[model samples]
Target: MRQTIESRQAELNAARLRMLNKKQEAGDRRQEAGDRRREAGGRGRWTEIA
Candidate 1:
């Protein structure tokens, strides 16, 4: 019973790490896309209102 609990805990920890990694990757993509958009249009173009 103790071993089963430990294995379950390990699996939970692994899942949490995977989720965190995916979240970080998404944030990086968002930042990179934002950077590209700004570069494509001039500086401050991202914040300008139509």
Candidate 2:
């Protein structure tokens, strides 16, 4: 029973780690897009007044 619980906990931890990594990747993509837009021009394409 103890071993089973430990294995389940390990699986849960792995899943959490994967979720965190995915979140970080999404944030990185957003930052890269912002950098590209900034490089092209200061005004935001999405916003009308910026």
List runs of model 2 lying over 4 Å from the truth: 47-50
Residue-level lDDT of model 1, residues 10-42, one tens digit each, is 999999999999999999998888777767774
Clashing residue pairs in all predictions, respectively, total 0, 0
Off by over 4 Å in 1: 42-50
Q: Write the per-residue lDDT of candidate 2 for residues 1-50, one digit (tens) a residue.
A: 99999999999999999999999999999888777777777675543233
**What TM-score against the true fold does each predicted structure earn?**
0.77, 0.84
Best by lDDT: 1
TM-score of 1: 0.77
RMSD of each: 3.5, 2.8
